[model samples]
Structure formats: structure tokens, C-alpha cells
Target: MNNKPVGRAPNFTNACIVMFGVNITWVLVVIWSLWGLLAAVFLGLGVNHLIERGRVWAAARQAASIRRGKRF
Candidate 1:
């Protein structure tokens, strides 16, 4: 049984995370296509912030889990 993660999973979050072997999505592009540059710019900033927040949250959770002697 081979158990190993290739990379980050695909999600609606952002294309920054490579999945399998590629950057899965171009959310900003889609937004720009449907809307305009102004919308894409503003929404893109929000998404960037969300990614940062998610990183911080993940780090905190990982630290807590380690302190409790847990591993996944």
C-alpha cells in the first residue's frame, strides 16, 4: 500500500496551490472575464487576504495538534 500525498487538493480557493501536477484554477481570470478589471482587482485582493488568513489558521491548528502529540 503506497500512501503519499502528491500535492495540495483542488478547491475553489486559489490557483496558488499546486494540485496533482498543476495549478488547478485561475479564479481572477474567470472573474475578469465575467465582470471587469475593477471587479477582478478588488475581489482578487480579498482572495489574497483569505489565503493569508487560511495559512495562519492552518499553522495554529498544526501547532496545537503537535502540542497534544497528535499526527495525521
Candidate 2:
């Protein structure tokens, strides 16, 4: 029986890790000082941008790999 998993699991894992790291950093910033709230807001926005870009990159890479007849 074939046991290989399907789809972009690595990309999902990377995205989740990035999101978790961003949230933890934000929490730490909030705990550090009230002044850090602004920084946290910007950080959150940056993280969102990064996640979107990463997904796009991953999808493109996956498609290329598929076209090459290989698993990503």
C-alpha cells in the first residue's frame, strides 16, 4: 500500500510556525511596555504580509515542481 501523504504539508507547517512566532513576539512586546503596542500593531501587519507572500511563493514552487514531475 502507498503511504505517502498528499498536498502542501510543509508549506502549511511553515505558515503556522511563522504565525505562532509572530503572535508570541507580539505578546512579549505588549508585556514589555505600553509604548510597544504600536510596534506590535506594525509587526502584526508585517506578519500578515509575510504569510501572504510565503503562501504565494509556496504555491508557485509547488506548481513548478509538479510541472517537473516531482514531489514538493
Best-performing candidate as measured by lDDT: 2
lDDT digits (tens) for residues 20-65 of candidate 2: 8898786858754775666767767887899899999999999999
Question: Candidate 1 at 66: error in angstroms?
Answer: 1.2
lDDT of 2: 0.82
**Going through the candidates in order, what is the number of backbone clashes in each?**
0, 0
lDDT of 1 by residue, 1-72 (tens): 879868986775554444522522466677778998888898868877998999999999999999999973
Error of 1 at 21 (Å): 12
Task: Show where candidate 2 strays beyond 4 Å.
Answer: 1-28, 31-34
In model 2, pairs of residues that clash are none
Off by over 4 Å in 1: 1-27
Q: What's the TM-score of every candidate structure?
A: 0.52, 0.54
**How accurate locally is residue 34 in candidate 2, as Cα lDDT from 0 to 100?**
71
Residue 50, model 2, lDDT: 94
Q: Candidate 1: how many backbone clashes?
A: 0
Q: What is the lDDT of residue 72 in candidate 1?
A: 31
